[model samples]
Target: MSEPVSALQGAIFEGLVKVEEAGPCGMITLRGDLASTQVKTAATGVAGVDFPGQGEANCAGDKGLCWMSPDEILVLCPYDQAGAGVAAIDKLLAGTHYLATNVSDARARFVVSGLDAREVLAKLTPADMSPAGFAPGRFRRTRLAQVPAAFWMRDEHMFEVICFRSVAQYVFDILTAAATPGSEVGFF
Candidate 1:
């Protein structure tokens, strides 16, 4: 099968905020008991990073593990490593009631940065975008423009947002419009 291209290839645009496709990434959804030592150990071993605490994300090298819920996590790695990542995770959790599936193709990631990145997002989601509330390494499963989405800060100036592939185009367009000059939706 031909590798799927980014939903917005070379279609970056900037206004108050800079928006760009994060490119293809490997996303594996892991559903298991986080309280189990074996499960945690197996997840870390396969992800090359420790599982993040609730609402947090931990990155080691190119791998990032985001805590989705008490019993779920999303592992992010190089696109090419998705299959192996899933297989390794499965093997590690052998004999356990676990479900590990690659969801890379189902999601699209975008990076929103620049001085107004947070401001742009504030217009879309109810999430607290202030530094005091939603600091770096923190993540939230929220809606953007009424579309289900999730995002985490890479730092003070950058954030990565992921949404369903089917709505990637709509999300991108909404963000760009929000980031456009004179479209400021003041902070809450």
Candidate 2:
């Protein structure tokens, strides 16, 4: 069997909240006519944490947590919890028609936090970054450097960015450059 790919490790930059490519963080994608019930029960059973509604984000235990959608949740847990977490959720949803898969390897996430975080995002995204515009716990699907990305506002000055593995690096570079002082020439 091919070895699993380890999370990305590299130089950490100051003023940047790099969400290192999370390890096999557990993921369960509930899909079915009654998926909402399964989602509610599973989320509540997980220590009374409520599942976020559509286009919302929720964090638990101070760890990097996010809800991708009403039917999908991304939990950042240690590698050992990957299987057990999914199993626990699956058990709670015994009769529901839901699908749970380990999708940690399929996506890449990064967080940019600092005073300039919103400014940096404004360089690329068309959505307003103001509190009234992109409130905390809210997420939006938008283009970043011309590539599709999911932008989740974690707080006033932090955002969780997710995109396909292939384009992650490109998107990162673009955002990083935009955060720099002189690289703001051509970005719109």
Q: Give the Å error, residue 115, model 2.
A: 0.5
Query: Candidate 2 has which clashing residue pairs, if any?
Result: none
Give me the candidate number with maximum lDDT.
1
| 41-149: candidate 1 lDDT, tens digit per residue | 8678767887789999887656888988889989888888999988998888889899999999899999999877889998889888887889888989999977999
Worst 10 residues of 2 by lDDT: 15-24
For residues 1-188, could you state the per-residue lDDT of candidate 2 as single tens digits?
A: 55555344332344333333333344444443334766666654542455566666676543334555544565545545556767877888777677666565666666777666766777788878666777777878788868888777667767767777677677767777667754443322
TM-score of each: 0.94, 0.75
Candidate 2 Cα deviation (angstroms), residue 146: 2.4
How far is 105's C-alpha from truth in model 2 (Å)? 1.4
Give Cα distance to truth, residue 113, candidate 1, Å: 0.7
Cα deviation in Å at residue 10, candidate 1? 4.1
